[model samples]
Target: MAGLPSAITVYEVGPRDGLQNEAEPVPTAVKAELVRRLLAAGLPVVEATSFVHPRWVPQLADAGELLDTLAGDLGDAARDLPVLVPNERGLDRALERGCRHVAVFGSATETFAQRNLNRSWDQQFAMFAPVVERALAAGADVRAYVSMCFGDPWEGDVDPDRVVETGQRLLAMGATQLSLGDTIGVGTAGQVGDLVRRFVAAGTPVDRLALHFHDTYGQALANVLAGLLAGVTTYDASAGGLGGCPYAESATGNLATEDLLWFCRGLGIDTGVDLDAVVAASAWLADARGRPSPSAVVRALTG
Candidate 1:
């Protein structure tokens, strides 16, 4: 606790990132309710959905409809909703729906870039440039997610320098913030510390960076602690630990929002989130999905 920030921001990704990979289609109304519950639970930033084509991620096909519902229902709370836009077309859809905050995803490795975006690293940046430019010009906040920042399933042990370079490019492309992702869940605490330090040294502002980790290797919280020590304040988490990269075979569920809240609570760090409420939401989501909640905290507390 000596060097960590007194408070941190948790960006909830359960409705979008969490449910996008589910094999079964979650009803559009269910997704709307999930976002509502997460907001009611005091999550400051909730990623609502993605504008990716339904042909690819059919689960989130109702992205525009969901946004419309939230706009009419959530009112001011809807201002915090951020959706993922994969390219110019996705950005166009989001803008047409009056989205104020959006995120574009890229990769640090060539394999994931080609697999997920159908482009190489340079090409991916080229693809994102216009999206970022158009979003910023439209007065929307743009967040960039750089995947495989720590390790890639195909290319193990990604270089920190490369990660920094990718993050810088994103920031330069009008991205208001960068979320560095450990896509394969192979990152360690030490690796996190080194990477954050390198980013800070290379002139990247700590406040503009976020960490997105998967709990596959059971190292999510440890790496989070490391990020905290390195002065990172924003983190991305999914309720009930519900998401994994569909393109990466070995990747697993994201760091559970309830689990992260529990850890932050124990550290006396303020996340402005209710742990019990998040657990209840996760439990509800699990029941709806016809599966057990993957969050350790949710399971233990509910049981």
Candidate 2:
């Protein structure tokens, strides 16, 4: 009844997630270069850009052009790009740009979902419903993400049952895969395990579930391991562990892809990624940002 895999997939969100919260505006060339370097690092699925309002995320205003332009340039490497598109306009833009896979996000908390989408949970799905239908009809893969799945900045702890309900709603709306995010990175291993177990118990099927964690307290890797044990084979990561929620006051970086690769390789899990290239890319970004990488492996290697 499910299409789960024995191995995991590492979706690199660096181009979109890593650069979104930069204190200074990152040039479009730099963003494109980041995607190029990620492709070189052997990532099969990369979240390239977000097609939301420029006023909300000025960092990704070039989402459409990036898609339009990068399509040809990626060449053989072009097949792995996944863009974050929030609305019908974005889907149209992506379709015009020929994006094969698109990602849309909703949040698990009522308050945060409303704050982000300006729509309640039901309204959010109602909105994404058409986009999902169109993407599927166009033969594009759709990944549905739910932010603040573990916890939210405004809303404290969220109910597991509510999270399952939201996930089910997204799936019922035809979202092929679902990603659960730790928006503020406040989840522990026990909490992460419990949440993943709850979703699995609710018949959400582990294969369709993905984890997006922030290493705010250095626990994201631990959480990833827990998810893998729960039969969740997909996790989202950002290069150099960069990026945080602009709305979340004290949030840190998303879990670094380089570090996660290191962990997976240690456990004999095939990441299909190159650690050296990822480290080099991380180093370059860290130097550009003037911030030490949150990844332990990067810090150790650079030091």
Candidate 3:
């Protein structure tokens, strides 16, 4: 707590990354309610949805409709919600719907690039170039999610240098921020600290980088502490630990917002998020999903 930043940004991914892995598509109205609830709970940046083709991610097929529903209530504020766009078509759809904050998903390993993006490691950049450029042209902010940054399911341990290179390129391409993801949640605290320092040594600002860790190995919070020690100020979390990689079979739920909030509160770091409100939201969503939340904090608080 002494060395960490006094405040940090918690980017809420529950609506998009959290719901995308559901077995069935969530109703559009429900998804809109979730976004409103998260916003009301003081999550500064709640990602609304993804524009990927329904054939690939049918769970989020109602991307457009979801945005429309939010717009009706939130008006101009809806445009500030970040959404994932996989390509030019997806970007077009998001922009047309007045989404001002967009993100592109990239992979740190070649096997994942091939499987997830259907492009080789190098090829994926070309696919992302137009999307980033066009989004910037349309007066939008672009965030690049570099997944499998720590370890990959197929490729095994990923090189930290390679992750830094990918992140630097994304920033060079006009992406304002990079969220390095430990897709399988196999990274240790030492590895997380080293990676953040490595990126900083390579001239990537710590403020422009974010840490997105999964809880599979039960190291998500520890890894976040390491990132904080290395000066990262942004983190990605989902309400109720509600996300996983649809492409990688070994991946698990993301760091729960409630868990992160409890951690930050203990350290006296201001996240501007209401822990009780988020717990309530997650509890509501758990019923909608017809299951108990995987988050420890949510369970203990609501149990």
| Per-candidate count of clashing residue pairs (backbone under 3 Å) | 0, 0, 0
lDDT of 2 by residue, 179-262 (tens): 999888888888888988888788888788889999888889889877777778889998888889776766789999888888
Model 1 per-residue lDDT tens digits across residues 1-303: 699788999999989999888998798888888988898899999999999999889988999888888888988667568999999999999888778899999999888999999999889989999999999999999999999988888888898898999999999988999999998899999999999899899999999999999988999999999999999999999999999887897889999999999999999999999888889889988888889999999999999
How many steric clashes does model 3 contain? 0
Model 1 residue pairs with clashes: none
Cα lDDT for residue 150, candidate 1: 86
Model 2, stretches more than 4 Å misplaced? 1-6, 76-80
**Evaluated with lDDT, which candidate comes out highest?**
3
Tell me the lDDT of model 2 at 49.
87
Off by over 4 Å in 1: none
lDDT of 2 at 81: 83
Q: What is the lDDT of residue 60 in candidate 1?
A: 89
Count of clashes in candidate 1: 0
lDDT of each: 0.91, 0.83, 0.95
